[model samples]
Target: MAMTAAPPRVVATEAALALIARLLARHGPLMFHQSGGCCDGSSPMCYARGELLLGEQDVYLGDIGGQPFHIGAAQYEYWKHTQIIIDAVPGRGGMFSLEGPEGMRFHSRSRLFDDAEWAALVAQQPACFQADQKL
Candidate 1:
């Protein structure tokens, strides 16, 4: 039997990708995390690569706009069955996120995965989750 590839846990809109490219050009490299912190109200937070530390308690949701995205394991538990849609909007994001001063913000929209999608995701092996990633 042939197994189908799981759908990405996270995806970004064209505008988000464009902003990411611009940020990358300015920042050299980047990463993203959403910890439901106070300032952003759960919005995706962008950071320069190595600016933040990733712990085993963080769940790697996957990449968005060619950069890795993650969330606290507790948050992941709440979001595990959903698909995260990343978008760029005009506003101030988290104070610490790289996008705060760019006149744009990275936002996260999510919807629960359908049964088929969930099944496919669950069928995948351990490779899907990144642990203890540096930078």
Candidate 2:
């Protein structure tokens, strides 16, 4: 039997994709970091590649629209069981995010992973979650 690919931990909606395309055309390359609350209120902040410094505390969730997406390690511990859905919403984005001037923000929505998806993800990256022992 052929092995199926695991579902992505992060994904973007069509509007978010279109916005990312626009940002890419103007900015060259982009990246996303899901804010861990506080001033940013958990919004997904978009930046030009290399704009923000990522340290060991950041976990690379996956890519959306070819841009890498990451979340803080502590936040990931809470969010690991859910699929992160990136959406474009009408609003001023995080003060530091590129989308602020565009009148749209990258928002995060999520749904808990069903048992099958959770199993596949665990099987695919057993080492990554070993510390949590979520299995």
Candidate 3:
């Protein structure tokens, strides 16, 4: 298989990581999950610490505001092309959002998964995830 790459060319500000550390410290544990949301149903999501790297996944588990936040291998792969970064703002605010190097903005939303993600999850753990009753 071809080697997957790292996330986009975006970097986080020191202030952001600092704020995240504070948030995680207060929340304890967290959960980063994904679900079908768009035409492809392909969304990348990560939250608390866990062992779920399925690819060249760059899983980062650290203190985000005192709580643990995780980014799996899947995200690392996609990050290579998106130029996405999680940063801090002037005030306490939302969990996480994506931004580009050109100063573009992409807000976080509910999970969006394509068929591939679902298949991968099912392949990895058949017992997990509910069957698509709509099918």
Candidate 4:
């Protein structure tokens, strides 16, 4: 039997996509980094592409609304078993995020992958799963 591809590790809700489109129109290309810090740092921060300096410990999870999404490697270790869903809500966004002034904030929701999904993900990206094994 042919093996199907694993599902994406990240996705955006329609509300989040709408906000992203608006941000893109004003800021050009964009990117997202899930903060591992306290308070606002736990939220997803959106920035103009290349605005944030990525370190060696950042892991690229996937894309949402055509923008790349990433998280700290340490954070990724704690979240590798779940799928990240980006949603937009009424609130002040992360202080550094572009959406703060727009009266909406980006939020992260997650669900754990099932056994088959986890197996497929591991089969599809052995290297990534292998690194998690070391944690």
TM-score for each predicted model, relative to the true structure = 0.87, 0.92, 0.30, 0.91
lDDT of 4 by residue, 5-69 (tens): 78899999999999999999999999999999886868999999999999999999999999999
Instruction: Compare candidates 1 and 4 on TM-score and give the better one.
Output: 4
The count of backbone overlaps in candidate 4 is 0
lDDT of 1 by residue, 67-108 (tens): 999899889777887889999999887878888888999888
lDDT of 1 at 113: 78
lDDT of each: 0.84, 0.91, 0.37, 0.91
Candidate 2, 1-135: lDDT as tens digits: 544567999999999999999999999889999999888898999999999999999999999999999999999988999999999999999998999999999999999987777777887875865566353
lDDT (Cα, tens digit) per residue for candidate 3, span 1-135: 532332223334466455445434654444432312443133333334443333344444333334333445555344322333444444322233221121332223223334444344334434543354111
- Which wins on lDDT, candidate 1 or candidate 2? 2
Worst 10 residues of 3 by lDDT: 97-106
TM-score of 4: 0.91
Show where candidate 2 strays beyond 4 Å.
1-4, 131-135
Candidate 3 global lDDT: 0.37
Better of 1 and 3 by TM-score: 1
